[model samples]
Target: MQKILLFTLILFGIDSIFAVTHFLQYVYSGSSGIPNLPEFMTVGLVDGEPFTYYDSNIRREVPRQEWVTKAVDDDYWDRNTQVSMDTEPVFKNNREIAKQCFNQTGGIHTVQWMYGCEWEDETGATGALHQFGYDGSDFIALDFKTMTYVAPVMQAFPTKQKWDSDRARMDYLKSYFTQECIEWLKKYVSYGKSTLERTVHPEVSLLQKDPSSPVTCHATGFFPKGIVVTWQKDGVDIHSDVWVGETLPNGDGTFQIASKLTVKPQDWKTNSYSCVVQHKSLQDDIAVLLEEKNIKRTNQGGVSWGIIVGFVAAALALVAVVTGVVLWRRSRTGYGKAGTSDTDSENSSQQQPKA
Candidate 1:
């Protein structure tokens, strides 16, 4: 049997994306009296992983690199110089501005300067945002979305016309804010995308829905996102009762989704209910058929004991035919037929679909 590649349609409502998550965060943490402060930035996850890039106003604030570079070669020196030396003071000024913003906000907070693009199937599909945030508080540093500052700054507020003019200047400056964030963002996404893995196609199971059992099809652990999971009853397509969910990340970077249909109890009894999945990676759609013979308990909603018994009787007859044919062949040639050679074998073949 072909393997199942996807899942059911009960409306899981997972957010879908045309692109994966891409993010850059520049953060600053400081005490009441400190001339030099720590520096950090990350991609994808916040500070969940190691710092993708770093810089500090004072050289002493830089983290020791011996442990990190021991495994790396001499070529790593170039990157070290770029992040810690050439670009160090840029974030230093940003750090001071961020620290000022944090103190103004009246809390012990780290400033999160984020710049990135993202896409989701729900709400909206594609978007990008650049903003400043306080770690534990709810205030913005530089509100890039509106091109304004969310909290009061050292500089006084401007007139309407002056605000627009300053905003235009701010826009020009942000084009260069990456310093190292954008490059790091690219490296982060590249590494994430490279670690791809394929999952076993979704499993489809049934629950009798009073007069019918809603068949749920789950297609999980696939990558590059385009997989179609649909329901078919008695070899015919179903629509009115079918639903398909959005593709969601599996954290491992692979994706999963579900599709479902409510099938009638009568149809469930005598017909083939197959959840067919199609993906470009696969040569053909994998079909998982809910068969009557496999259903137990004649009266247990989905059970079809009559058909199960019929299959048993047919199976026994076919076995007898094959045994007799093997015996006759052995008697004549002194060797049994190694495979099916009886007339009943012809009846067991199924009609293949035309291309």
Candidate 2:
């Protein structure tokens, strides 16, 4: 009986240790100040592992199994390197910059900057400004404060991996801002919306030739987890013959989502086919046109083919007349003799008659 009790106690002790470990591994705390510390600290765990504390005055990481401090210099935290907190002004400026950048390049995927209102220092004069944009494949960064451009940050991992990494970064940034900054910039940054931008590749193959036969389109893209995909005809939502595939996570961190839909060929021909994707922060719709056999001509009776033919004929005649005049001029020499044989007898008679 005593042996059984001892074994039970040992099991309970092991369970308690595991519970405590799990709690400590995932614990997070953020505040204005910490006791016995000169500067405030924002502490958190990364994937159940403890890391360093981040704050305005002191940015340092706690060493594992050692009493060492990894300190970050104040100069390294450039106040001008930050984004602006004035939502309207920042958004307005950002939109303009984004449009210019997109026009110069093609499109942008991400934009980052330090907030003016959320400046760590009381001066509110400086903050870091970073912008990230993409041209379909490669990622690019721009520093607004320095007006400097960085080289493209190539996506090293597959689409899924890239998405996951971005998600982690966004999550970390949100937590960091909420804890460290006096004013939360997450509401204005559009980080959630930017992360939701995705490109879907869809292929459609004709299944049947009948007018009533349904035409289908398939799409696949790397998107954030929990995104919703829907099919639309023209501007209206569609619910017929839709198939949504399972979203798979990429090894690095992102996810791949696929979906398919079928609609009447006639409807597809007359209306636009679209895929609308939705996420917590962003919403976008992509569409493809369905080929139409019958289309109305806009210019009904304005111009006729006969008029064009007549104009061309007149132009050709004018060219022919000009060509004939050129040939005639070339054929006649300065003496006005062109292949006309002037017999010696005739020439002599003419000369004598004239005398």
Candidate 3:
């Protein structure tokens, strides 16, 4: 009876140990598929084995449910989906993306597409469309039907990374439109050939004098083709003579136009002058401040005279010292000879007296 009891106890201990080890391994391996696992897999397996084992069978039976539950609970999946949707239109060459983004965000006001001839010719399609809006903003091609937005990866205008604000970006766009785009448009687009023009404006600089002298000012800007240049004084047109400088072509196929206007000294301060440029796409003026060109004199007043006098005085003092030394030596010689003669005469007289 003792042997049988002891043997039964040993078997029970062995079975418990094996069961604990298996439970721990299962819990540690996350075979339960629960969102949160227990701290001690052995304890959880001992208590949760039936539940976890049953869940695994259920998951295998209803795979679709498992997928749906995972999708609903996973934050990472949602974020990735949003990003994928946002970038889909750009990569798919769909223009409707812009419209969707605009409508959804209520941020973009307008969209325009300016067509380029080169692109059209190469692709056998219409050129790219340049879009603009009332808010001083613009977008390119957007396909409303397909919900797609497509923009050139690289554009002539400064990109968002290069500018601090939308206003700065717009300003750069306007400048580029006047300087580079218009010329390119004219070359490629049939309609632009007749509408584009280039112009030049001149200014004046002042030279410093009793009051000051006036200098000529010149500036040049590229436009389409037939732009005009004018001078204005205090907002009034200056009727002064204007010289038109030669227009050179910018290597980029744009015109380099120049103008010169002669301004007088009296007109420098009394009137505010500006060089006005007028073009099909741009109407602006550059104000030139008449700056005084004063000559800088390194040697002013009698500052050098003091330096010359000091040098001459030092040389004269040196010569006087040498002359005094020579005179002293001659006097010493004369005194010595006289003293010797007197001594000899005294000795002779004394000897004669003694005789």
Candidate 4:
């Protein structure tokens, strides 16, 4: 079974050259024997930004984005809430069925259903996916070509057979992916245009904890996630001795990354060194020289910049780490990438859509 690549849907900034691709996705998860978490949870995302959420504990479908709340009325929420309420039992039943199929008495287990659609405005191209997972692995998925369900594991074959035989369910899924899902995606995009379509360039900072430690080029507050941070030596890209961190989400829906270069103090002094940032938001790459004066010093006098920044950076890093761990754990138990389906069109069965 192919693992869902969580970062496959790449949302572009405003200055992008390529045409934008939008995504609408809903993930439903049900878990057993997990503590301090809702038994069933649902998340709806548009262009990778969560717009709505529902959990057993809340028992209500709530809008996560301000625009979502503004765009839809109380009736909309009420209707979706009912839908989610109905879905909760189905997810619970799925979990129980999955446990039995696996022959597990169960310590902790999860069942997940992820379904969504993607549309490319420029090309009139569309794609869709619907998949079910059992214990972090692919259980069954919809096959567009066969117009039937596929089982990845023997334990899931029964489900595939049953679902394939259910003509009503199959037709509903087909319509949901290609039609209903795309309509909803377009509506959400229209509602969140300003927030989703705009771009914010990164704030570049050269940070160094100490002279002996590697110098880090930090770029924060960029929108749309796609970015490149690299080290340059004497006007040339330097690949070795450089560690580029993963792009991480900021609290305000932007992104940040850090690229560290290991070099001797003498080496950088003798040869010109710089950190370069490339993004759709910028017309040209922004380069910050690796110079002592430009460095954001962490060695200030008594009770200074070092203490404050060190504390804040540490806190932010801790939060990112914890959040990543939680998401990773959830993905391991379910909540992974959408399963790839067989289809005629190249864009018809993507695992996840870029928005």
Which candidate's lDDT is highest?
4
TM of each candidate vs. truth = 0.37, 0.23, 0.23, 0.69
On TM-score, the leading prediction is 4
**Candidate 3 to truth, TM:** 0.23
Worst 10 residues of 1 by lDDT: 1-10
After superposition, the stretches of candidate 2 with alpha carbons farther than 4 Å from their true spots are 1-221, 250-252, 280-283, 289-355
Residues 1-355 of candidate 2 have per-residue lDDT tens digits of 3322322222222212112111111111111112432222222221112222333344333332111121223442242122111122332333344445445433222221111112212233212212222211222222232233333332312222333344445454344433443232222122222322232332222222344544333322333334455677776877878776543323222333445565665666677876665533233344444454322122344223343233333321121111122132223221111110111111111111000
Q: Considering summed lDDT, which 10 consecutive residues are worst modelled in model 2?
A: 346-355
User: What lDDT, from 0 to 1, does candidate 3 have?
Assistant: 0.27
Q: Give the per-residue lDDT of model 3 (tens digit) for 40-126.
A: 111011111111111111221111112223322346334433433332222222223333433433332211111111112232221
lDDT, candidate 4, 1-355, per-residue tens: 2212222433222213244777777776667787776777777777656677778888987777899877776698778888778767666666666566567786877766667777777776677767766565666677665678766566656556666677876676677777878887888889999887888898888888788889988888787667778899999999999997656555456767778899999999999999999887899999999999888765653223343344334422222121122233333323223331111111122223212
The residue-by-residue lDDT of candidate 1 on 63-97, one tens digit each, is 22223333335655455545335333433344355
After aligning candidate 3 to the native by TM-score, how far in Å is the CA of 138 from where it should be? 49
Please list the Cα RMSD from the true structure of every candidate, rounded to 1 decimal place.
25.4, 34.9, 48.9, 7.4
Off by over 4 Å in 4: 1-17, 32-35, 99-108, 134-136, 145-154, 205-217, 231-246, 258-274, 289-355
lDDT at 317 for candidate 2? 15
Higher-TM-score candidate of 2 and 4: 4
lDDT of 4 at 248: 54
- Model 1 stretches with alpha carbons more than 4 Å out: 1-115, 118-185, 189-193, 196-213, 224-226, 233-237, 249-254, 268-272, 292-355
